[model samples]
Target: MKTTFISTQAVSSATRLSIMKMQAELAKNSKELGSGRWADVGLELGNKTGRTVSLRQDFARLDSIKDTNGLVMSRLDGSQAALEGMLKMAQDFSASLIGVRTGDTGADVIQDDAKNNLQALIASLNTSIDGEYLFAGIDTDVRPVTDYYATPVVPGTGPKAAVDDAFLTAFGMAQNDPAVINITPAAMDAFLNGAFAAMFDPAAWTDPTTGWSSASDQNVRSRISTSELVDTSANANEAAFRKIAMAYTMVTEFASSNLSEGAYQTVIDKAAEIVGEAISSTTVVMARLGTAQERVKNANDRMDVQMKILNTHINDLELVDPYEAQTRVTALETQLDMAYALTARAQQLSLLNYL
Candidate 1:
């Protein structure tokens, strides 16, 4: 028959091309397995690896967020501690006043104790973490109290017998009214010591001459409940009244023995009442601090949750799948072997069979 012989070369070439295409596909899927996502090569025919990659990245982010939660919790813990200290100190002072003997010795002893407690209290207010003051109200950059001099309690060094005005400044509050002590600390000390001239000492506290206006420093931190933030020119209101209400009671009650039941006797009771209110207000302050601590903890938890979701996503996107990769490798190896054997067999073929 007059017919052209078709070459085995053509058949083998077509088979090789088909095998190569399948091989390429297998390799791509294998990569996606190891990478935990499809690696789209932009070949017009295939690519679906985007989702896995995105999820894997998310997983990584979640892990980072979880780490941050620990730090946030630690900070909240510290803040809670500071607030508790303030409450405890205030409580003890109140209890002492409530149980005051109203005698000179009793008042004097109580005043001495108060002075020590106030020093400790101011130290607590200046508590800091990472060099940031916690009780500085809004002015955390500075210490809530200062050692302006070796003896801040000394007259002329600053206000006498008063919470260090420097402490007020550190918290960024203004006390332009320099007459805070009403009597120099030295003279007040002499009076407390029972010196006869203490009554006439210019430095000594005279209830009549001493200013009682809420504007005076005697009531500066009155509003100093936990939530009370003292600011520059912050009006002395119920807040400042709350802060020194206890101090007012101690001062007046001790002086009560000196003053007979007269016009100012009622004033002493009023001062005592004010101090009692301050103690009540301190309880409210503790509650507010507790709230702040809770809020900070909550915020940290939310961040942690978000991070977890991200971590899972990142893992899915980035990691390799051993089973799928192994399957692809095996399948591709088999196809390669089959194609090589077919090519070898084709090369040996010729027209010998036909002859």
Candidate 2:
């Protein structure tokens, strides 16, 4: 074996290098011990870094979806509540129409109530959540229903106008005319179930030069999850709303003096029929909303579970065993102390000091 002699300068340099390395290890272990995760994940994970990055990206995307799903759930809840309110109003109005005397002075009171209910129904249909109109379909910025009190002066311009035109064209009378009692089921059929009904159709909405026009894009949809898109809102363009509005219009206009008692009763009966049908249709829409809300809730549940699993995976990749890290930190502290002691000793071993 050949004998090797190392110079004092070389020994000092080597000692300094060893102490620096020990200090680096001490810092890393201390950080891991305090944080319970790897301080340098890339260094620790190496080839697995890509997988960790990908998992985090997935988490971010999922979190974003969950946020959107929460908003959608809120919108659905609001829509359901509004529809329920409208249905209740319609039900009450229908129940009031029963067995009413044609000469009842309460017609004014009832008409007043009908106007209030109509306004409330419009308010409900125009419900907004977080500043977005839930019933406005894709046109969230536009209100879905124009105020019912607006005169139908411009034919074919708005809901009130559409309704007024249908009545004038069908019955040869203004909507308030007592002769509306002459409107047979055949005449009311078109208003209730035919072309006039189609006017309330989402597809029939045209670009009126003004406020919300009935456009075919009525149902509002939201992506609840990566793989799922759901219709989260119902628009006001459904037949139910039109039926209610028309009935309300007729009832609010009804006065005992406008017609013979028999004719007034006939109008009341027709209003009842229309409002009843509106109630049924509103119920159906509520049922559909219930189903949609349930689907969104289920998706949220699924995402919650997936998020837990993903967190676990992320922890496995990036977290350190707390106990092990503490032990390593203590060991590194001891090694660092020993290296400092050795370096101090090395500084004293210079050849010039020996001289």
Candidate 3:
């Protein structure tokens, strides 16, 4: 040790290494100071890194679910609005039917209102948001209801055509036939309870070409939270819609003015009854949708709380003290400056200058 000699080259190499290390530390501290987070999270957390990783994953999952729940809530809101509008239409049409039944209004007024109501109903059920039909159940790509007033109405094709065929088949005559005037109330009732009712049955209503509804019976189900799933949509195939369609079709398609007073009153009475049932059924559907909306909102609230907690834990695991980081940065800059000065002085050293 007493005889040891150190060369300029060895001293220069050591200084260069020290300068590189100081530079790296300066950059790291600067980053930490700017971001207020660990410059190297894995290195800083080391053995605890897995905990932050898991927490981040959970946070991301909750965020994704919250976003999806937003879409679900939008769909539910649109459906509720559509159902409410349809309910109002049904109520108005029912009132008109009652007016006709009590002889306070003319039958023609009810017939015109029924036609308008049916068109409005079909339009409402076919409502879409973001190109997705709200009443299509799980078949979002398909239109839920057939337009009874759709132009170029072909025979044996579409809901209106099916109604026509059912009428002719049951009564052995067209709705506008002169013989309809002599038709008894019992015959009309039989037809209404039989062939007309069967048209809205699942098998017939689901027919691809001529059915009234192409929507699925199973509604859309959405995961509102990690552990909670709920129905987020309603289908046009519900019994309430079916009854409404029947009531509208009976008044709009039947030649009511051609019928005797007794048979005409029979139609009005039955249509009014069906409209009442439809309104009640629609109310139940709205109540169920309201419940789902409440659940989704609550789930979102809980997820928000969970996400906040997760963020706090992640911050604790990864955040750096800005003051400490700035102090380290200042120290590193001072050391780097000294190292640079020493290196510059060493490079200027020469035996020739001494000679």
Top lDDT: which candidate number? Answer: 3
Worst 10 residues of 2 by lDDT: 207-216
The lDDT-based order of candidates, best leading, equals: 3, 2, 1
Candidate 2: pairs in clash: 202-215, 202-216, 205-214
Worst 10 residues of 3 by lDDT: 98-107
lDDT of 1: 0.48
Q: Give the TM-score of candidate 1.
A: 0.49
Q: Following a full C-alpha superposition, what root-mean-square deviation does model 2 have from the true structure? A: 4.3
Candidate 3 residue spans exceeding 4 A from truth: 1-14, 102-105, 151-155, 343-355
Which pairs clash in the backbone of model 3?
Answer: none
Expressed as tens digits, the lDDT of each residue in 42-157 for candidate 1 is 34213444655455556555455446444444444665575566556666765766655454455455656666655565455556777755544444454544421235343543
Of the pair 2 and 3, which is ahead by lDDT? 3
Error of 3 at 28 (Å): 1.8
User: Local error of candidate 2 at 258, Å?
Assistant: 2.2
Report how far off residue 281 is in candidate 1 (Å). Answer: 2.7
Estimate the TM-score of every prediction: 0.49, 0.78, 0.90
